[model samples]
Target: MLDQLSYKDKNTFLQNVHTAAILTYLAALLLLPLILAHPLYLLGVFLIGILAVVVSDAAQECLPFLVMGIWVAVFVMILNPLLVQNGTTVLFYGPELPVIGRLRITLEAICYGATMGVRLMAIILAFALYNAIVHPDKVTGLFSRFAWKSSLVVSLATRMIPSTARDLSNAREVQQMRGVNFSSGGFRERLKKYSWLLEVLLLSSLEGSLATAEAMQARGFGSRRRTCYNRELVRPRDYLCFLSGLSALIIGVYARFAGYANFSYYPQLDTLAAASDLIWLGVIILCLLLPLILSWGWKHWPYLRSKI
Candidate 1:
């Protein structure tokens, strides 16, 4: 259970799925949030993202990101009403300030902000799910065929996030052992204590990077004589996933072009999608979730594999 708290991929079917296949599905999953502005549609998309995280066993690992995204979404919700004053229905009107002018909040701005918030949450959860299932090594290797150094840098940066958190935890423990009390201080004093931790974290990160560079150099990394490693091969299952993902992607793109996925919130809010429009959204979601459905069946009904 403790292992679930970290972003380590388990030997689950979703985790073992071909990287390109999963990425194709991921692209389709992200497409809805990017083009759609209907609050209900975006909310549905975000809910699917949450479901994916739960199904992929990423709810725990992605908890921090979920919280952060919510905060950011709330910030958008609050900031938009203050910044934008273009709406037919005015909710609040405050006295004018010098440079900022009058403060006005409207239903349109509020609805738009909420829609944007939902969009952001959906996108963030998509990434959180990807990080949970996809191995950094696979991502690096996949892109390395094109840009080795750039891929390596990106992979390193992604991996460093979890390791850096662990390092900070270790540093906190060491400080506690040395009679340094971090939680016993007031706000300002606690900030000072945290500043100390940051200093230690920075130094350790720099030293670790230097050591990695030295080790790589010693191993003749990037040399012409470097040997090939075992490569990830695509199976029939991967191809199926890719096809389903492409199907979903095509549907989503068509929906956007048909304006079935867009909503208007400025001046006045547009009515939610009609029942006919929702059919496309439903199909897109079904296609996006095909991998999870397959994995569930594969895991729970072992005899099905024999038929396959």
Candidate 2:
């Protein structure tokens, strides 16, 4: 993510795809895990998002986020089983703690943890893909017309995360050279070591904020009326991408109302007895893949690019 964005020089399909279409595509990607709790469905979407990162040639830019997501999800998965004692299928009856009584790990609890982890992974992938393909300026321009402040905030956040991560990494390395072992001790010891890292990160963030404020003031951010120098143009295939995203959203809402996407792991995992979700899943996949498919097609076929 710290790598300079090279999306423009590539002349890939994503750069040509409409921003509205991409946002809608992302909307569908983000909508699934919120309303549905099934792990397989969520995993399917997450895998496809990874494919998107690969196809968009953003592996370098997006992989750190993917790795970070995996770490967080794994932490959640491991932590959930230790805390929740719901479910009949006993996996492990852990030791008693002071405040939290006996730790009873069950199959249902594990499944629920896995489901939650996968849901988070899917969400992270969606944001990573957005950061990879969509230009920050594009996002700023797209939403600025309706919600300038919101767009500005979103744009800054999207741009800031990678930089902040890079800063944290550098700070860690510098501390290591100074004999600060971030990974060599027990949990509490390591936590104390990180205090210095956190301090450095906080200072770096403040410096970045100051720089941003200065730059914005120099740009006349609040001096006068704003103008969009680079407006997006919606093309024919762009409409198709937009429509596909809207269709996925409709299908998802319908599935939610019909209870096709609902799953529970408390009593036990829900039986995969119904095939109704298959049809909706197919629609969702198509809608999810449409922009990517079109982009791939346009890139491979010069004639199609002329028309799309």
> Please, what is the TM-score per model?
0.78, 0.75
Give the Å error, residue 116, model 1.
Answer: 1.0
152-239: candidate 2 lDDT, tens digit per residue: 8888887787788889999999998998877798999998899988999999999999999999999999577888777778898889
For model 1, how does the per-residue alpha-carbon lDDT over 211-269 read when each residue is reduced to its tens digit?
99999899888986445587877776687778888997787778778888777787788
Q: How many residue pairs clash in each candidate?
A: 0, 0
Looking at model 1, report the run of 10 residues with the lowest lDDT sum.
1-10
Could you give me the TM-score of model 1 versus the true structure?
Answer: 0.78
Ten residues in a row with the worst lDDT in model 2?
1-10
Task: State the C-alpha lDDT per candidate.
Answer: 0.80, 0.81
Top candidate, metric TM-score: 1
Off by over 4 Å in 2: 4-9, 147-228
